[model samples]
Target chain A: MRALFLSLAATTILAGIAQAEPAIMPLDRATILAGSPFDFKIELDQVHAAADVAVTVNGQPYASVFGKPAEFVAEEKGKDGKVLGSALIARGLSIAKPGDYTVAVTAGTETKSVTWTVYGTPAVPTAKNVIFLLGDGLSVAHRTAARIMSKGMHDGKADGRLAMDDLDHMAFIGTSSTHSIATDSANTMSAYMTGHKSRVNALGVYADRTPSSLDDPKVETIAEALRRTTKKSVGIVSTAEIEDATPAAVVSHTRKRADKAEIVGMIYDVKPEVVLGGGSAYFLKSGIPGSKRKDDKDYISLFRDAGYTVATTATELKAADGSNSGKILGLFHTGNMDTKLDRSFLKTGTVDKFPDQPGLVDMTQTALDQLSKNPDGFFLMVEGASIDKMSHPMDWDRAVIETIEFDQAVGVAKDFARTHPDTLIVVAGDHTHGVSLIGTIDDDKPGTEMRDKVGVYDDAGYPNYTDADHDGYPDKIDVSRRLAIFSSNFPDYYETFRPKMDGPFEPAVKTETGDYVANEAYKDVPGAVLRVGNLPKSADTAVHAVDDVVLQATGPGSDEFKGYMEQSDVYRVLADAFALGAAQK
Target chain B: MPFALRRRQFLAALPALASLPRMARAEAPELTFDQLYGGYSALGLTFSDKVKLLDGQSVRIRGFMAPPLKAEAQFFVLTRVPMALCPFCSTDADWPDNIVVVYLEHRQTFVQPNRTIEVTGRLEHGSWVDPDTGFVSQLRLRDASFGLV
Candidate 1:
């Protein structure tokens, strides 16, 4: 035992400080934009004297390229005595050229090297206006089901058209993150907005070893680049809280997306010319009745002081336009805005409190009107956020209605693009969900069981939904025959045959063991059945799918988005269109 | 004469000691979760009349324990419904403002979320940032203990 202990101690010591070396900032295969600033840091495996370490870019010394010496720390402390070696940190560094740059570091046998493609765009701009519309977690089934539901299908061929069907360009975007295949909105949208693929929950920054949420190495956001490189205005509109992941991705850098208070501060720091959405909780001071902030920062007053015309209602939004207000800060609800079912039909959720919330179509049109006034043009991003929100609850009817609403918002953008031919309208989803419409659930079928009532193959008859208003949305959600939408991944949940009219479905509830189980609330629904979950019991809701989301675009720079591309490549098109890398002499 | 004086002093002390049992640790007024907030509005939630009346007093509330941020969390959130999703499940999920944090007096086994129980502790209100998690909550129950009812 003593002899074995001696060998074990030797082995433990070797592995102790011998874990994988810390990854440097602007990591391997990083594509840095020309003229844009980034933080540079090199972490070593073990402590080294300043004279012992050497870093070279393409066989040239690091100081020769950056023109500034890096500050070195001998020994850096990690979480609980996990000794990360010596480190060098340099803030706000840039390489303004279009070429392959190789970076190599040598710190006594612990050698690591990385390559970067610092690329620039053409000298001239490709588009004047950019309308980027993202449907959160949009899957192929939603589009196919929406086409069939909204427009009739006969002999495998029927339908007037969908708003996105006519787009001239298409791309299969790979939405994987730098860290994992499964990603959240922060990384995915950050890839789109910043031309960088960061780790999950990180936006516009490399996830670093630093404990400070704000101290991570940063990348320039598209909004910031546009502000720095051009005179164009910027706008952001989302159904989620303004500080939520996708909207916050326009301008934010944090290791965690839950830093909502800090995200609010970041938004104020950039101060996008026009901002509108829910989540007033962070804008109010801590003492305010509904404030979610712990700080005394009153963003509501701050935005007003910064020349924004704040509107709390749809009526006020309309009035603000007539009030000659060029910049509008619309806060329609405190949290995420109410879905269409609650806002128009059920009168539940938070609709009773925020009665005058504007629909996406109206919001899009109003935003276009305000943005068109900018002579230098504008870049507007409008998000249909709730498609994913309602889908998580397993509320199919509500989710489909929201899809229709989102499509209508697309229609609004298309209409504006028609008038403004110089505008580039790119409509796509940030990610795909596991949801699909397999068949119709016919109530008239002679069966007590819900699954027995499902119509398959040729027997799947057309659903009789009346569009008496001719406004596109069905008059009622509880028709005799309707689409049976199902998710590929979910926790233990009761499968109720009918739409949940009470509100969004709480599919799973936490048990004493900290594991999620089928919510007993729906146990009494007429044909409800408890479906044992295939996912881990810890999963409380349905998860996102790895399937590819369809992307379509039209206008000047849209021609570049062809075939398959990574989500990060979408940013390159955006940057090239705006000429973020063009020399601004 | 000295012995008689000492006897009189001892007799007076007996009455003072008798009143101590009645005067110490008096029972506090009861306040419920519904009574902690007056109104729910988009602008902000207002603390209830009962909350103002019983501020800094001992109060008791009955609710289910929502799943904690981590398995070893010292404080568990008391909620009206078993949170469908753990607020700490992901950065995406956030706790509702109505949540009451229960810092137990001693470690206790976490009960099923569907179960209801009563918590008694000193009522504390105002924004307090959790140093460990950076979770900012406006209302909390400090030095609390609870049991299944």
Candidate 2:
């Protein structure tokens, strides 16, 4: 398989080198959903007259195949009015047939040809609801640690299983984006939401050469598809800001995910029935103290006028669940919500300011209760956002504890699935972080040095954590013996083998030279040692790993996810489960 | 005399010089980062009474200097913690809520980022946008000068 992939990559590069043809959107061998709307575009290498250019599909004129005429521009100007090339665009085009389509474009001697495989699903649906739970940047080590920490371990094995461990079907998902092997949360989740792979930092659109983020080729997002073909309600829940990349991918189209202000307008455009998370900062006017917007448009008031109940805290969210309008918009924090370790266990990390933030479990339950009110069923997406946020800073304790909290949310979804067997629950991660638990760190076995206290293979024993209060979290994070996890890549930082009892860790900071350096705040800790970074000086923290993410699923239509699949392929299974191709109207 | 002893003797003579009634006295109030905000909510933050009272008055604050937005600029950001991202370089980097923008009184070389520095200036509180750079800040310190603490 490795050899085949490398050779195919080599052949594609050689073909591109051999031809000076126009670049096209949806590159060769693309698998498109039948009858799904997409923007078709072709970029010619040189300016050409509309009469001189010819486009064909399957030996027929493109106009005859798509039943529409393409808009042609003799010269496409780039940034600062520089002439890039000539272009042709056809918007809102869909192919209704299930077959291989060969699209060829020619202008004088410049020519390019690509093929797409259009697939159709069964006419009948296999599931009534689809719940996708994504733990951003989740990795195997996080799962292992969450299981060991929450469920406890004995005699090197038999503790118990996590909510995700017992899924009936599992697969290894390749999460590489279109442009590179490495991936971020934006494109990775975008591919899952829209069955098309895109470049990094892009969501629901192909990365184009244009400077304008909005002009990129657009694709139909899952939420838009549900609105188009079904009567089902849609809900988006996350611990991060709702306008963040993961949740925004459900109904957004921009080449850049950082276009967050624009993303708020996109969310308003769709106006899903339930939207819960942090990020009220973008909804406020500029005069408001916590407002992050440069404009004066108040989205909170806009949504309220649109008949949506807005909740700002846990108590308000619970109250708004009884809203007669059946639409709830909960903004718990101005930024990312505080984690469970801060809100429940430690009572640190901005908990004083926002004391009543809800946990992911409670938010998920609220979403389920409201979304299920619709008789036609619903499509819900929940995200455990801080699992990735804390991992980037190499805060292993916080990251692992966040994983535990995420698993508890998964348990809630599983409980709902048990009652509604027709519901499909898909649990996966957008990408993987390079983190792993090596062994135990036993304070009892140590001299003065913390490094000497690290217990390796034979000396490693089970961690001593208690759940005396019956809460899922360990009673205390400052255990005498604890798991030692580390990231493969990290910025310059001081390695302290203990939990940050104050707040989330800030391992590195930027210097005046624009390079990252180890923060000296932790330098005074008794056994802390400075570890030179393995990453570049420009990187502020650890980066995402290129390894494949593990995807697990249960309920109806899960058997289809059995082998290796691309991140985009996961969407095909989802569409098939709901029969999104058939017109329910 | 040793450099330390010489510096100590010079500092020791400052009180005697202050005894002269003709010299002006500095009355800069001290403030901490925790005292800047009274409450936080999703709607917005409320300024503490101390911050409102010290507005337009000379005050001293201690913090670490965040990386400046431009190589040659009139101001820098002072944060309770060292910043993780260069806001000028990364489009996605966000400033913390409690940052204090310090407009320098004169051109000075930037110091190492690992040490804490004390800044003295007139405190200004409001939502202000810098005209030249278009940088936005809720709190600011005007004509600020700093020294290593």
Candidate 3:
């Protein structure tokens, strides 16, 4: 019997050798919400007439199962105007049943098949609201450093705990992209928001072969799912541009996260109750002095006309909190907001230019205050963006401070959860940096070189960071002995074993040959040393790590997140908590 | 004899006196990155009085030359500090607000980003888009010539 079956499979393979298998969107083994809408697409290796192409779902006609016919293109053109292949596309397709579906396509001698699991939530919701707090590039090192810096360590024990440290349930999340082991903020956050894994730099969609960023195969974002099945308000808050990857993943569906200008339009389309962060340049008209848009669209006025209270400063943000409109759009900087170290302490970086920019805590609180007004509950995402931004430059001091700020924001969410016990709060990182907090750097160590001052094991003493004012941040970062952190990978750079007092670190600069070289600015420092890069010369800074991110949650349905899970699986817990599959409205 | 000698001296001095105005014209006023903007806000940026006064006039500024779009391109961006991230190389990076597009008088070899350069050119301000690369700039220097400072 086994020999006969092998022979049958060999005959089937031999009969279809004329062409390669076609490509299918949502790939294989995708888990989708039962009622969530998504795009269905297939790309054939060879062009086939509509008559020759056949599609079926569970051995039935595709149109009958899908309740609609897919549009067929005889020839799909590539970027260079060359005919690549034939294609079939169906937008906004959804399944209402909970089961396994096998979709098969056959065109001439080429065949491809994919299976998807359609899942459904309980008829009743488990959580009234959800607060997702994401610290971009938040790794174990950042958490350890923030704890040691904010709360002093004594006898090898933490004197205090971070707000995220008290979460009831936790999971180790795999953050790899669909195409590679390494990932970026866009792909990881998109996976959590859309329940679908995508390529790097992609959000709410599968990266297709097409050159157009907007035409990718779409997946429904959490914001859209709420808009479809419930009357819940959605809020997005971040220190980076609101149109940035993590926030944009909440409502955008672009193949490229760098499509910021287009992302603004997408955010406007969803019209979240509260949108706060930087990147106002993309919202302004091209005629505006600081505008980055190439088109004439003015999203600031568009959002204002949509009944949003626009605030440009922290003072205005506070005043706008009392706005009867219920919608707030706070844009404090023309670009990314300054780091917490620059905003509240050092007064470096762009702090002089955008001095009144609010921190992540303020934005998160404002979003909560406004969003909680909804009777149907709400979904608010607060991001500590500069944690990742500073991590990229290998500026450990600033990144740790940013993590502290993110933890404070988590505290605010915990405070909200106290009054609204039905609210579920999730604290996670989209991805991680290749950073580690090894030991301490003692200025008093007897050494001619900075590397000699590094302490490890027994010699690694505690950092002298103090929270004199008890604000959960060290009063001074440039202590005599400080936490010694390092990245596993970096470009050629001068390693200055001290805090960057002047501003954020700019370790490397590009040369004429498109290679990165150590910046000579730090060469004059007392004990600076040039460290040859472990990465390629093309890398300007340290890259993201492929390590799994830690996700913690509290409140109803939090038990779903335990042990090990995929980043995309986190969305399932969120959906089940909200009963997104069952229409609540 | 003394009168003839004095007249010869005056004749020689006439050439030097005639060149004084030309020398004054060649001495362009200098500008700094801090002086380019008077006010900055989320709404927009305002050109400083000095920047407004130097418009259409020859000016000199000191800044780091960013990598050009192309190896032999005629223009490049001038930044107040050496750019740690290449916006041209990575789509996620963006140019700072204080960048000035420099259109060189003649294409010159790009310099290392860490080295500051003194550029002399006619100052221009207002929103203008480069037709070749579609790069939009609010401030620019035309016919620029630069040398390491």
Candidate 4:
């Protein structure tokens, strides 16, 4: 027995030795924009003396290639004085050459190697302006539903096509993050804003084993790169909070997307010329009634002091548009703005509180008008964020209506692109949802139960929705016959076939046992049925699906966005389009 | 004293206080969710005159209890509607603008989140950060007791 115990101890020691290899940042096969700045870090498995550690780039000393020496820490400490390991940090390092560069790190007996491609673009730019439109959690069903609901459908064909449908180029974008097969808005949009695929919840940085969300190895965002290389302006517009993941990815560099207050400071650091969205709560001091911050810093007054005209309503946004200040900060709601279905016709949700909030179309047009004042160029990111927000709750009508609103916003961009031929418009989604439009639900069917009214295959006739106002949205979405959309995954929910006219759907509620149960509030709906959840009991709502997002682009640089490509590769095409490698100014 | 011990001592005296309250008590005014907000804007929300008049007075309100912050926590958030997400458990979750914090008079097991409960307590207003939890609440109910309607 003593001999067996000694052998077991020896086996454990050997396993530990086999796993002790150094970790290098700018992970293997990383694609970096040439001349763009990034941080290089090496975390050794064990504490090592400064003299014993060596790092080399392409067979040359690290300082010779990066033009600066790294700061070495003999032992990194944790909260309880726990020795984590030895680490080396090099900030703001760049490579001007366009080729694969291998980095090798050696710390005593431990060694690790990683290869990165430093890519450069042509000297001349192909596009003067770029408009990137992301419909958050957009899936094929949303486009199909939006087209059917907004444009209407005849016997077999759509009455008209969406503005996004007419784009010149298309690609299937793989949106998996570095750490998981599934992706979130932060990592997916961060990949577009920075030429790196990070783990979930991370933006413009690689997820490290640090406890602090802000101490991760950093990557330069597109907004930062544009500022570094050009004299153009930047504009961010979204229906969700301005500091939400999709918009925040353009300027933030944190390991957690929930660092919204810090993200506000990051946005201030970049200072996008025109910023419009619904995160006013974070900008207020903590003592204020509607404030969501934990600090006393008031960002609204700060932005005003910096010459940004603050607008809180649609009328105020239009009024600001007339001014020559050339900068606008619009916070229409304290949180995410009400969806179009609520803001336009229903007058529900938080619309009664924020009565005059601008829709995505109005915000996009205002951003374009203000951004065009710059003769050099501008990069504007317009996000239809509520498509995901409503989807999580299984609110199909609201999500489809938001998609219609998003398409109308696309029409506004396309109209601008028509006149300004040099503008490049790229429309895509950060990720997809587990939603699909199978057929139609007709109230005319002979049945007391709503599920019996669902018509599939040939019985699934086109919906009857009228758009007499010509506002590009259905006059009313709660028509007798409507599109049937369902999520593939959901918690215990009441599947009411009819549209939720009273307000947005709340399909599930948490129980005392910390498990989600079907919300009994909707139990009395005409034909509501309790559908047992397929997801884990811990899930409160439907989750995002791991699917390829469809991307479409138009104008000069659009040809590069073809074939199946990783989400990070799309950023390379954007960099090449504006020739961001070499300074344009 | 330890919080658990202090709480037990408070609970021990609750029955005597309740017997005295039955002798001379006026019916508490009931407040609604809509009555809490006088005006709303992107800048801030104003408390209604009704809410101001009833400050520190016994009031009854009906709302759904959100999932408790912890099994042993002494407070829970009261929301106008059933909360689908627990803000404390989910990293990305955030509370709606008009949640009311309820500090219980005594420790009690959490009730079903979907059921509406009527809570009676002294209405407290203004920004107050909890000393133990550091939670910021604009409106609160002190010494609250709740029962399902």
Winning candidate number (lDDT): 3
What is the CA-based DockQ of model 2?
0.54
* Residue A256 lDDT, candidate 1, scale 0-100: 87
Q: Write the per-residue lDDT of candidate 4 for residues A1-585, one digit (tens) a residue.
A: 999999999999999878677778889999999999999899887999999998888999989999999999888877788888999999889989999999999888889999999999989989999999999999999999999888887868899999889998999999999989999999999999998999999999988766789999999999999999999999999999999999999999999999989999999999999999998989988988888888999999999999999999999999999999998999998899999999988999989899999999999999999999999989999999999999999999999999988988999999999999999999999999999999999999998989889989988888888999887788888888889899999999889898899889988889878899999999998898999999999999999899999999999899999999999999988898899999987
Checking candidate 2 for backbone clashes, the offending pairs are none
DockQ of each: 0.35, 0.54, 0.58, 0.63
Give TM-score, chain B, model 2: 0.82
Error of 1 at A478 (Å): 1.9
Better of 2 and 4 by DockQ: 4
Model 2 C-alpha lDDT per residue in residues A1-585, reported as the tens digit of each score: 999999999999999888576978877777788888988889888889899899999999999999899899888888899988889988889998999999999997889999988989888889999999999999999999988888799987937788899988999999999989999988999999999899888999888776899888888899998998899999999999899899999999999888888999999999999999998888887767777787888999999999999999999999988777789999988888988888887888889889999989999999999999988889999999999989988888888888888888889999999999999999999999999999889989948889999887888788998878757678899899999888999999999998988888888988888789998989998799999999999999899999999999999999999889999999999999989889786
Top DockQ prediction, candidate number: 4
Candidate 1: the clashing residue pairs are A289-B44, A289-B45, A290-B44, A290-B45, A512-B112, B38-B48
Prediction 1 TM-score vs. true? 0.88
Model no. 1, DockQ:
0.35
After superposing candidate 4 on the true structure, give the runs of residues whose Cα lies further than 4 Å from its correct spot. Answer: A1-21, A77-82, B1-26
Residue A229 miss distance in model 4 (angstroms): 1.1
Can you write out model 3's per-residue Cα lDDT over A70-107, one digit (the tens) per residue?
99988998999888799999999999999999999999
Each prediction's number of clashing residue pairs: 6, 0, 0, 0
Worst 10-residue lDDT window, candidate 2 chain B: B16-25
Tell me the tens digit of each residue's lDDT in model 3 across B1-149.
69889656544544433333444335999999999999889988889999999999988899998888887676899999999999998867999999999997665667789989878789999999999899999999998777656
Ranking of candidates on lDDT, top first: 3, 4, 2, 1
Model 3 iRMSD vs. native? 0.8
